[model samples]
Structures are given as C-alpha cells and as structure tokens.
Target: MKRTVRNLLALTLVLAAGAAAKADEVLLQSAKSGLYVTVVNGTLAASAQDARQAVKLDTVRLEGNKIAFRDVRSGTYVRAGVGQGTMLATGSPHIRSWETFELDRTGRGEVALRSSQNGLYVRAGVGRGSHLAAVSERARDWETFRLVDVRNAGGHQDRPRPGQGNGNGNHNAGQGPDLSSLIGNYRITHVTADNGFLVPLGRELAGRARMSIEGRGNLSATAGCNSISARIAVENGRFQTRSQPMSTKMGCVIRGQSLVENRISQILTEARTVQRDGRIVTLRARNGAELLKLRRM
Candidate 1:
C-alpha cells in the first residue's frame, strides 16, 4: 500500500491534496506585532480570507508587481490574493528560488516548463517549486490559495525568536485590517533630505524610495538609493513602520556625509498614516503634517 501511494505521488504535480494536511511542521508563534517577512517569489499562495495575522507576510524586495520573498519562514503563514509572472521564458527552464515556495517537507519542488507557454508565467506559491517542468503552460494564470506551513526547507527558522526584537513566548498578534485598500505602490518623490535640511545635495538617489501593499494587512517598501528596507503594519486600521534595519549610507557627495542619514531619520519620523481621500492616498505624519501623496499607476 505504501509503495502504491509512493508511486501515485508523481513529481509532475504542483501541490498534492494531502500535502498541507500531512506535511511535517512545527507550530510558529509570531514575535512582533506583524510578521516581518519577504516574498521569495512574486507569486503568493493563500486567499483573501486567510490573510490574517496568523498568516500574514511582507515583501521588501520588489519592483512593480515582479517580486518574490527572500524565504518563507517555517510555519510562517500568509493569506493573499496575489499574482505571478515568469521572469524567464527559456534557458534551462529556470525557476528562481524566491519565485517559488512551499509548506511540505517531503514534497519535491521544481520549475517545469510546458509547450505553448511564453513570457514570465506567474502562479500560486503553494506548490510553486514542484511540477515546474510540466505544469507551466497548463496551470491557471492566477489562483488564490488558502493554506499555511513553511515546509522543511532546511533554512526555515524553527519559530520566531523570543524577546530579541519584541519576540516573546506569545506573538504580539493583532487582528489586522484589510490592507488591500491601503495596499498599492507609493512613488517616493523625495529621496529624504540632507543634514537636518530638505533636498539632497549630492548625486540623486539611484533607486527612489517606494512603498507597496503586497496583500491586505501588509506593507513593504524600499528607500535610500535602494540601500534601506521598509516594512509596515496595518493592525486595527493603525499603521506602523518598522525600524529600518539597513542604515542609511555614508560618505556623501559634498552635501555632508550625514545628509542621507538625516533625511532617512526625518522621513522615518515624519511618516505616518496611510490616509486616502477620493483616489488620493496620502501618507502623513501626525495630524496632517507634510504627507506624500500617491495614486494608482
């Protein structure tokens, strides 16, 4: 019987019926308020209903809709109505690790290509790495998956650390709001300021700052010539940005080496509220302070 089941398990399948249910896993207890995570692939698994704090994630590395998480931590869950696009149409049938994710330990992950499919094909992350060779062209263009688990990637963390950066025995869990309304790319017009002043005095920023909504209840962004990372949270309709882990770069171009640093600090300090008023989404700081306005692009 086991042999029959083993034979029934074919590598061409993306996700099996029992994968989520039968996979080996450890219960994950979130540490911080909102689970801070990266999308290894642009495609997202799970559905709108499952986008709860128990299954929420963030993606800091992205340009437009093309994205992927660095890695989905073990037991890290996310429920998002997301999409995906193929980065490469050819060349050894490539599948970027960040573009694929799973929650089954024994499950085999692959990126199989099929005839008739061209361009970057996006898919759900549930069984992305698996069945890539044959399911590329036949799979749905987009699908909302509903399930959780990090599988046994061998790199997934056992669980959120305790007390290091707000991690405790119990995660700071909060029933976050539906962030889809708040989610969208915010074009950063100003690249922070300089030396306690406004406007940088050196070479303009390489990659401008950008904040986006990867899914409901989650916010992710980048800043400072692409040298910094931004992660935000929307719990109970209250928004909060995490402390930038990557410090602003030093050694400026004549406007003061600390110019960018100061600018980042100001932006960080001033940034608040993802407020919207009839198609105009404005991010302001404390009581209608100077805000950055954004629109659907």
Candidate 2:
C-alpha cells in the first residue's frame, strides 16, 4: 500500500509540472488592433489573423519579475531596439537586457510588455505598418495585448467581441473612439498649474487659446502667442506627444500671455489622459491633475 501511494504522488507531481509548462506558451495579440504579434521575414509585426498563424512564444520567467519571450519554432528571442530605434525584432539566441520584458497585467486579463533595456512599454504600431515597437512611455491601449494560450488556441480569435471592453478602458473592443470624435477644433476653456508648476490663468485667454487635432496624429495649438505643432498618439482615452512640439518664436506682447503659452506647450506634451463628456474634453496628467479643459467647436 505504501509503494502504490508513492507512485501516485509522483504521478501527480509530474502532471502539475506539465501543466505549469504548458501555461507559459501563448500567442500575444494586440489589444488595440486585434492583431497577433508574428514574425514576418524575421521582423516582429502584429498582423496575423488568428492564433494558428501567430508565432508561439514561450514565456520564460526570470528574477525581478522580468520575463523573456522565445519563439518556439525559430528558437530565437524577441529583442527591443536600442537607443532611438523603437522597433522590435526577433533573432537573438540568448536572453539579454533587450530581450527581457516585464509583463504589466491589467485586471481584465490583458497585459503590456515593458522592455528592460529602454524602460519603455511595447506598443503595437498599427498606424505605422502594424509593427511591434517598444517606444511608448505609458502602457495604454496600443501597449496592451491579450495572451492566448497555445494549448487552447485552436481556431481562437483574439479580437474581442462587440460590446466587450478590450481591457484598455475602450468599450468598443479593440478599437478606440473614432477619430471624428476628437479630430476637430477646440477652444481652451480652462487651464491650471499643478504639481508646483505655476501658470497664471486669467480670463483674457479664454477664447484666445485654440487647438486643432488633424488626421495622422497632427496637432496644432495656440495659447494667445506662439503656435505649437506636434505629432500625437491617441488610444484608450489617453494621448501622448511624440516629442517636443515646434513653436513659432513669437514674443508675446500681451501681459501674462507668454506664461500661458509656455504652460500650454507643457500641458500638450505632458497630458496623458483625455476625457470627453459631451462637447467638453478635459485633459489631465497621469496623477489625475487637470491640465487643460476645452470645448469642442
């Protein structure tokens, strides 16, 4: 009886180990575009139709909550681009800093990958040729992905069903709010300085400050002085500018107007969360500090 019990206990341990190993195999699907991250011609792209075509990734857990993804078929690891290059490629045989990523999982079963090398979140660049890149500083919609278990992914579709949330706060299920809802003229109604930044907000600049969001992430704005232009990415009710905005070097003749311009420029670049309630759109920082409040025109 003792020998039979020992054999059964050992069998149980083996089954548990096998289940744990199978759980690590998954197919990463972009939450923003509903595309699977696949290797196409040795480059990482989010364009696969379903799990069958997606690259099978083995998640290797490491110390410090870091994980590395290895392509099961090619025996290669995913590497994030270094320096200013944001694209992610696959070909590394060993796990290094660039191949290491931290999974930031949302409560709704979605996850984002933060590269250990650049400390940036991996984003599915749907607008930029559907490529995967580690460029986003914040893990918003484009950075979020759904991990489908390979063992259970037979004919599995990663796209969220209609009326379901994609776990990124967008209710449309893999699609953000239509650009028409945000691509229009807006008049700055209110501005406030927070986190020790001082910007004198007066009544004179109420209607004078204007902003326009055009197609393809183009944003142009003015705050009673110099005009500012920059490219922005909007997803999951959040928006971030690519880089420092270009501003016309026009000196403000109005009192307190230059300070407002400086504040507006700073707000445009730092505001991460956007909320549209009817015709009013409020932009806020990550810490929930209100920055700019505008009315759609």
lDDT of 1 at 78: 24
Please give each candidate's TM-score: 0.29, 0.44
- What lDDT is reached at residue 256 by model 2? 66
- lDDT of model 2 at residue 133? 78
Best by lDDT: 2
Cα lDDT tens digits for candidate 1, 97-180: 323333212122222112222332333333432111112333342211222343432343434333122111012223323356
Worst 10 residues of 2 by lDDT: 164-173
- List clash counts for every candidate, in order: 27, 0
Best by TM-score: 2
Q: Which stretches of candidate 2 lie over 4 Å from their true place?
A: 1-23, 82-84, 157-297
* lDDT value, residue 154 of candidate 2: 86
Each prediction's Cα lDDT score? 0.33, 0.68
Model 1: CA > 4 A from native: 1-178, 190-207, 216-224, 235-237, 242-245, 248-265
Over 126-230, each residue of candidate 2 has an lDDT whose tens digit, in order, gives 344467778889989889999888887787665633422121212221243444578899888777643322233467776588889987878888877889888
